[model samples]
Target: MKKYLLLMTVVLAALSFTSCMEELGSYEYMDANEIKIDSIKGQSITQYDTLRIVPTITQSRNTSEENLEYLWYWYKSGAGENAKIDTLGFDRNLNYYVAAVPGLYSARLKITDKETGLFARKEFDISVEAENSGLLILSDLNGNANLSLLNFANIFSQDIYYAANGEYAGTNPVGIADIDNAGTDLHMIAILCADGRGGVVTEPTSFVKISDYSDLFYVMPQPIAPEAYCAVAVLYNTGMGITYDFIINNGKLHYRDFQYAAYEPLFNPEVSGDYSLAPYAILNNNTLLFYDNKNYCFNILKCSYGQLKETKLDPVPLPEGTDTETLAFDPRNVGLEMVYAAKGWKKMDNDAGYAYGIFRKPGSTDLTNMYCLRFNIGYNMSMGRDYFTPYFKHSISGATDLDKATAFAMSRQDPYLYYAYKNKIYSYDLEFDKGKVIYDTDTVVGPGARVDYLYFRPDNESFNMWAATSVEGSTEKTGSIHVLGLGRNGDIVKVDTVYRNVCGKVVGMTYKNR
Candidate 1:
């Protein structure tokens, strides 16, 4: 009871503080000017808990509500693609009296109907990161359940548990544990920063429900690093964070003390010019690509001690002629698509500059002849004049200093990268040249600095991500920790979100080896 009260009080106080904060002067109440969005601006990650949800919500008329009906939606995933999978029709204001489950699920609601008997339905796919997935359910610490593992990857057999199988019942078993008891395994283990609390299914018939404990996984030392926050589930094997550990425990995963190895790059900037570095990383069979906007000519950087070395994949010129900003290696080689951004320019592309392009080049080893993204600042980050790159190449480019290419951990999913800019997250589909918004702060920016610190846990099948939003002096006191759900077909679901209103600063997030 005491723990519950403390948690509630902390969350409520934070919520109040956020609401009391003043709005920026740049954004004022404009009665005349209006920015209308045909759909919700960016309904990226939704949540079940209201009070715990950091950014306070009031009202907004900036969206198009013509077709949005006052209806409810619920789905196992965030994509509202298949209505059947995304079941609809439920309570209007109050869906689940309490936050439904701790796992990530897709759901949204529309106001009232005006045109027809039904109102317009604005179904924006949202990831709900239940904030309490790791908290032990005090009421049922003894009641546990066991799950029969379906060896799709290794343990293949006739027995399998599908969505049709009444959802996974049985509690208080042994061996198996829930990284975080989110009620439903809507999120696979390590799908997002490790929930820590999950059911454990052991060989000798043992299981432990995730709801049994709050300490599913914990960082080893005094203060935990921010980057050890949330990790995206891609290749469970590769564990890395900006400044923390992607540790594992008894099959569960979370942050812990680990080794730190920093080295410098071996190569130097010898390209078309001294272009900003934009190295790329891919995950899930090159289906996704992440980029950093360093705009340096080189990509791979081996940091040893305080020195950094650049390992060149291709031979090029100097930092004089080119005006590019990023580079990438589609880990799967797939050679080229092996891409980089912002090429063919003198400097920041003074004359409206160049439009960043995704290109391909040669590679080392068996990584060749694949789809490589190639272009000079003259033809950068763009397919053609008709379609533009998601982001531009100019400083005028919305890219922030923090906007640099993200070096994906050395894993099977090498290229599907994770990065943040202006404190927003975007996942790129190299195959489709498409960008998906993972989290957005147009709802609430400032008072905090948003940086991308993602980590992956091998055992728990989850990853953690953190956005440092609030600060004091030079200290970061609050952050919205988000869990990324890795599911079928590069599908993403937000498991949960939490704000740490404590004393800490997010050091460049990276995972440490134990």
Candidate 2:
């Protein structure tokens, strides 16, 4: 019985082998098209520059080039799953003009064989830089507001705001603020004007208007008065950093936390306060120190839990073992009104220390009696009411014409507070309690040129003073911007660069980072 079974199995195996051979011989085989992409070079170009890429491709089979479909596109590098893919072209080569903002990108070429349904792809890095980036001077030109750019290459481009927007930013432009981390979409430039037009937020790279000032609020105020705009970075307890953009309109604080949504109407109710704020304020890590002009005192806005809560600063306290007579002024209830206030040189671990403000008694017309008040809001808000401390209160010394000064700026590199008075620039050394003339615009720029604005680039570590000046009697392109190099002792070393007669009467300036 076993021998008979072996025979049957051999017979079945032989039949199955013959069947497989016959099936194999009946089938036909052909080579499929395989795509090969050659190495493509990386690209580096400025915004608005043409980005051209010609790729070399080959196929393994004898397929016609017409049978292939091509796609060229780019997206922000490292965007991962949320990357926004922008189509560059749908051709074999790329010749796309880059209108994208300044950033790192990844350009890709994808070739697909339409017949074989096979694909090949190649990717290369691309760096897009701003074509016009540097100091942006917002000036009042011929009764209108204009924006000018002094580029990194030392070339000046005037009326950039008008060129891009086809209209003036607004008449009587008072200030410009760069929202470096406005949102994930892009940086923003807030152009503020006092001409009842409020302000406009524009794209940082192109100066293209994004929205009108009224559009930035959930419920617009009755009379729009945009005074200042600033974005401050605050670190939370969860180890996350959030940037909140603060807008001061008619002495009210309006803020938006970009982490929640992009450009949503700033949180409503404006900080729940009845006090009118001064036009100037200082921002520490998670706290905003604002002086209430109505109450003649200071208010603290502590940023936490994605909401701004008012923190009551304890009364100014004398340090342990210090003389009670050494106290200068009460920070919580300062009796004077602020004229100009700026962040000082002293910095704590997580906060700005010793902010200086020039103040005078309310309803007093005597500017010469103005006093310099220095104080610090403690670095740690967890300390509760103990955060407010007064440092110095004294009359400004060794400087003349305090009443005639138009602008004031403080140097973070040193204890020098600079003020622009007519045609001269004076520096008051806060540490030494002395003041002296730093630069004379009349002698340097021209005979009738007067300093109209004084600012130090907030990001620059060195003391490169920026002064905006104009002729006393003219408003038509009479503005000039100078970058003055400063010595360690707070003296002007030389005039490094100057843009003469570039825009209108300069009122405000801010640096635009690339």
Candidate 3:
């Protein structure tokens, strides 16, 4: 009886163990779909170049029974909140793509197990470089309205009157201003000082807008004046949705809009005398602030997009006994686009020329005292002096030695103010209040070359400074386009003479980024 009972107990125990093992196996079984993305790297290509995306995907569970769907999408990389993701295409295999523009792009690869409705996604970044990237040099054909175009990408190639109308007389460009409207870039070439032929002084002062490749858009008439062209500044009013072309003809400030057919003068003539020098103007707080050399004061003009108004801002005071004619203002400033006037005076009885800076705030309308630059001129500098000698520097030995600041071009994006001093280019750090020689024109081009004007590339990363160079004593009225790299310290990094022996002196040069 006892043996039979023990055998029964063992049988029961074995049956129970078998049931538990079967339940455990059922719970541990995994039927969920699994996928792994093998392509997680980035890519790089030039603008308009083709890109291929070959993705390797693997499914771990029931691979043979499952069908997968693939989707590809892309958008501008680092677009942040403004990113608008666009679908590239949908296919089982997305292997091709092309970016039509230059910028960083982000691409996504999505794969879904169609049967199980399970999906996985992977993303990558791509960089597209600009295709037509380099420089466009506007030069002259020696006193003729025949301007030459020298593309730095193909430095040796030359084209004359790149985009001129045969009906237009030969006009020397006094200044070139670029305005980027929406996505289209427009260049305003101020036609002035033309020898009696193509749109000369008698032909009615005017300017033409052209596309980046020198295609003509329209020719607009400027105020008829015998005054030599001083400067041309182009700016867009975001508020009123207007584009303004401000021109200084023989010291008078006049403006015209693309929407209008006529040019109009700004401010009343009773406020001051003829603006003697080119009006140095800049955009500040959506208003235009300019320096009036005749009055030796800074003035402000505002545009609401439809009409213009003057701020009635008081003029920055000039130094006592300093002739307003001897003072020149650099339109470029470190911050807020304020006006900085440089005045140098070497009295007939004195051997040294005293130079100093006068500053005004962007929106200030008070005529009270203007801020003065209390710093030294040369290597060694101390605080508190409102002026310094332009010619003599302690480190630059000799009498009547060292170049004085001649022409000025302030980096629109940096704190450094560039000036053509003594035939060389020097950069002055407004923050550090120190000056450094960036390029030696005597070495880059030749001695006796004068930089009539300087243009800094609006996009600062290129480290480029374009100068319109003219030789003082050259028999032929010729000029050259000098390109200098502003990246390195102490000396200029890259120097290229894009065009030489131009028929006429280069009065102005600017870059239009494509």
Candidate 4:
């Protein structure tokens, strides 16, 4: 009885299936609109270039153009799920000015058939390249800040900050730092000023303002005063390495580590200390030396786990076999105020490099009696006191009109120190303890023209000096930027080029790499 009932159930199911198939075949069927997009391809363009794309569309049901809606948008590639999507246009075509940061992105075109409520999308890759790469000059135009660019082709773009942002960078420009290779996503140009507005950071490629100086700190200081910026490489014992960007503001030091994922601020808290710091700092691999103006001493900071720790410097012990006198002053407690400091050449096998600092006795009005202190830097303090011990201290001899100098720069390949006084640039060889005038604006730029700034390209293997000079006229000051080459013996070998009357009282300069 059970087998018979099962057979009957199977027969009934087959009959019902046949009836349903016949009923469905008796009804009419309509094809839905199928949209297809083509003719769009990946693109490679430079920043600020016009990105135009016209995608060809086809529909199986021949849908009317009026019934189709178009949308175009893009987002940075690899910025998963929460990526920032920017709308381009609502038309079938796309015309966008590529103002995005230099990087890879994905652009998409979406077409929707309003009648059928069906949509189709096509995505393609885009690579945006930096439009400008060369030297960026930050100058004080009257009282406002002006940023200019000198490209590899020798073309000059003036007031690029205003051209891109429709406003000045800030007032009282102090310095500019190109922070490349600081981290995976930390490439930027920092324009520092002493104005209450602090300063600004911009996209290295587009010159678009990223944020103000206060936005970079976790807790913004009441009054902002930015003085200097630098980036240093930090190597670990496990063969790992990273670069960190440092900024000195309000006589304090702050650092940024962008590697680890966290909600922490872009810059860490100010390095805790009671002393007022100088505007200048010397950075090397894993270490930084800051001069405390209030205490008249040098403070050492070592990098560990993305944080800076104040380290103590051991006293220098004189070598037994040599007649070299003991260091006249202790680095930790020099009784003089810091006038200037600069990084010198590094030995081939040493992780640390030589550095020089100019100092004068407290409350001393005579600059002619200033002294130079030499020391090593950039090594791990855990390697022992011998790694970065002070080398020597001596008077800055043979530098004429040292009291009148306005700017100074040190050579990284030799013991050549360059300083500008009035209209002359002199190079003092620390090795020979002598000085000579290498560039005289009385003959080159003009008589009575004053040297406003001096800098050496940090990346250049050879000495390439950048000097900014200005001559005061009855109406205004005319500024010129000269790129001069230095020979092996620390003398001006040739004038590479000169941009005359290009800016106003050039104060700071930095190189923007490609």
Candidate 5:
């Protein structure tokens, strides 16, 4: 059996996983006697089986003279009041349950503030489907409100993705990401949805926009039609091939209409068909850089904003069977030069510590004249980290090895690459080819700062980039953003703490110029 491992978020700092905290919402103002009824909130029930309806209630009496009270109203559409839930718990929680044939139902909330005289009443309705599908919720992140489904006792795992609009385009979404393009308010995102029958979760819409989304979108549509999307690779009727539907303005979703044709890759014998992994980056409105699946080759697709030109090919000769995924491109490299962490010891067929290597895209094809940054494969995982003792000079001698990094962000005045280790942030000056490690000072970051997400702000000076660190591990994702120091040249410069917002599992990070 093949063990499953997530490539994006690499080896994690292990920690205890806690049940997600009660993520709830509350009202702003309330009074004991004011004529106000808090909107009925926190109503959860199962499908046709066992139903647990727990609605929060609060009531108060002014001056601390009177006590709080609680009441629950449970009734059918036409029934008066035969079954009423008036029970309270030690923590003043109301737990009421009902079991009925799948249909419409109503529940009420009664709140009485204990210290002061205040009371309110509210009611809401819920319809339990024939069979409970899954619990769904919406989160507005980067203009995209994704539908996150939980508690489904079914398959091994599922991946889900959202259209630029609110529609869930791809299948079950296991992971989603967006990397900014040129001037458009857009980026590429993929949904790792599960394939109905098993092993591989077909990566559909290897890229999708987040701005164009909708609430009318359903994960499972009736009559069964493969949702029109961009596919990394599809097993069509004839055979398996690459497929992508250029999105026109989806009517159901009010989005911008793209003046382009939907794409259907007609197999060409002239070219060695390779479109397995779609990793393309649009540098601007004109230049497009992409890597085919297997990471064996890279292509630069040049085109006008309206028409895509012929793909320029280049062979990235790896150490025999060594495969690569996460690659970073540097815009300031003399030519189209970039770096990617390769696998080391796995290349037992090769030399010592020849695990991962950083190959530069010096010129187009022919990997003859290439430079290897690090001949070790240890940095292959998406979140893997290795620290160098304070004595390594050849590797850190003026920040030379810093070029073999995964994170790269560029701006008008400042452009830099980052190698996020366990306790410190290393910065390599792109112009000088030398790097420096930044330490947390009394005023800057903590002694051992762990960065999760990082980006460069185009408008800030002195501090060009910002770092967001997880407070603990992926679960207790306590993290904050700090400023970058540009004062010292060769020494480790400390950063300053500026913003803080603890995240949950700090999944992925993308910096939009906006």
Candidate 6:
């Protein structure tokens, strides 16, 4: 029985093998001769950047041995959806310039077999960064304004509005106001001027949106009295699509277009004298902080975004005899909202330190819950005596007493505060409560140079400080703009005198992202 089963199994296997061979012989095949497009990948580009792409055509067994034709085009979405696709020359390699406004874009490449009727297509995407980013130097040319532009790509200055626009030509520019508008391209620049500042107009003009190399766009008007503005700042609330341009002129604070009238004279009208100090003020955390030099107090007003106008001037209560000119609001302090200011009438206060305080407003109440502290101690006992030592070889050497707060710049990225006194720069560490002289302008700008203004570059991680120093008794009012590079810990790393022989004293300086 076993032999008979084995015989039957062998016979069945033989019959199956023969059937499989017959099925394989009857199968049909075709040649692969079609043309295919090579996949193209997406790209990222900056505005005005050149993007080069090369595409290849894949040929199969049936494809003809003929030259291939190519075409490339790109288009952007949004309002430019109806715009024409920029066509490139008939070439396999595309060298395109990404000059369009920053946005997402789509591009296509087409290939055709010249000899055969076969064709193929490919598509890809691109992202471009926003343009018009640079630094604007408002050269107060002895009252006549000269707008000097310094793009990141270049170090030298270029007069962006000199002969380009007739309106800004030979105009006396008091200062320029800039606001960082989130989301939209509403970031605008307003050249503020008055008859006193050597400007053609007596009052400030509307904020002008810059286009195509400082060409003035439509102006966003702000109500202003025919008076010279001492300080100006633009507050933008992108979430609510509202903007307010604030200006301090003739000892009055004005905002919006007469939405509400100016703050009811925060200063004493009896003080009839020329206060040469430019009104010191800054916009911080949705609040406008200004110094009432006439009253010797700090004034705070909670700004309402997108409100057509303010109904009344509700100022946060502040102690009188506060030094507004020496006020420095530290943006780095998040938890404790502290503002540092040199206390005026030092004899009355008798405090060895500047009058700085932390304040908080609760709920809907206008009252400010506050705590004031005088940080007069310069040397930290915990770190020993030498730990607070500073390098003073070429710059102002020696220890700095924190009592004379004078003019200071607050670092946004670190706990260090840079203060200028006489011709020396001092670094004060808030965390350790220690202070030391970091840089001296005595050797760099000659003996009699007095450091007046200090500015911290907001866009730089290195915490680069720009200082303006004027010679004590120079007849020409000659000064120099020095750039000091600081280390991560906020110590002076290097120094460079970028501008020298400045004819006029620099009243104020701030970094503006173009």
| Reference-based TM-score of each model | 0.25, 0.71, 0.54, 0.69, 0.35, 0.51
In model 4, what are the clashing residue pairs, if there are any?
A: none
Per-residue lDDT of 271-337 in model 6, one digit per residue for the tens? 2232211244433224344444433333444434323223333333323554433433322121232
Q: Which one wins by TM-score: 3 or 4?
A: 4
TM-score, prediction 5: 0.35
lDDT of candidate 4 over 171-228, digit per residue (tens): 9889987766523544677888888878898988778999997888888866688888
Model 3 alpha-carbon miss at residue 296, Å: 1.1
Number of backbone collisions per candidate: 135, 0, 7, 0, 50, 5
lDDT of 2 at 230: 69
Candidate 1: Cα lDDT at 432 = 43
lDDT tens digits by residue: candidate 5, 1-514: 1233553223332221222222223335654354345435543444434444444333233433235555655443333456444332322345444445333456565656555545566677644432323322222232222333222222111223333234543333223322222122223433322333111111212323332222113222222221222222211211222212221111011111122424212212122233432322212222222334334344443334334434333332233343232223221121324343222222222111232223444443333333333222222111112211111112224543243333334322332445554445666543345556654422354553455444543212234455555444333323444555554342335544354433322223322111
Of the candidates shown, which would achieve the greatest TM-score relative to the real structure? 2
Give, for candidate 4, the lowest lDDT window spanning 10 residues: 233-242
Q: Residue 11 deviation, candidate 1, in Å?
A: 99
Candidate 5, 90: how far from true, in Å?
61
Question: lDDT tens digits, residues 84-103, model 3?
Answer: 98887777555454555555
Q: Ranking under TM-score, best-scoring first?
A: 2, 4, 3, 6, 5, 1
lDDT of prediction 5: 0.34
Q: Model 3 segments beyond 4 Å from truth?
A: 1-136, 146-157, 163-169, 183-245, 256-277, 303-406, 412-414, 421-423, 431-436, 442-453, 467-483, 487-504
- What TM-score does prediction 4 earn? 0.69
In model 6, the clashing pairs are: 33-62, 172-198, 296-322, 395-440, 396-440
Shift of residue 407 alpha carbon in model 2, Å: 1.2
Winner on lDDT between 2 and 6 is: 2
Q: CA lDDT of 262 in candidate 1? A: 38
- lDDT score of model 6? 0.48
Q: What is the lDDT of residue 316 in candidate 2?
A: 33
Model 2 C-alpha lDDT versus the unseen true structure: 0.76
lDDT by residue for model 2 (191-287), tens: 9889897878898878899988788777887578888876665312122333666777888877776656644445454766677778887775555
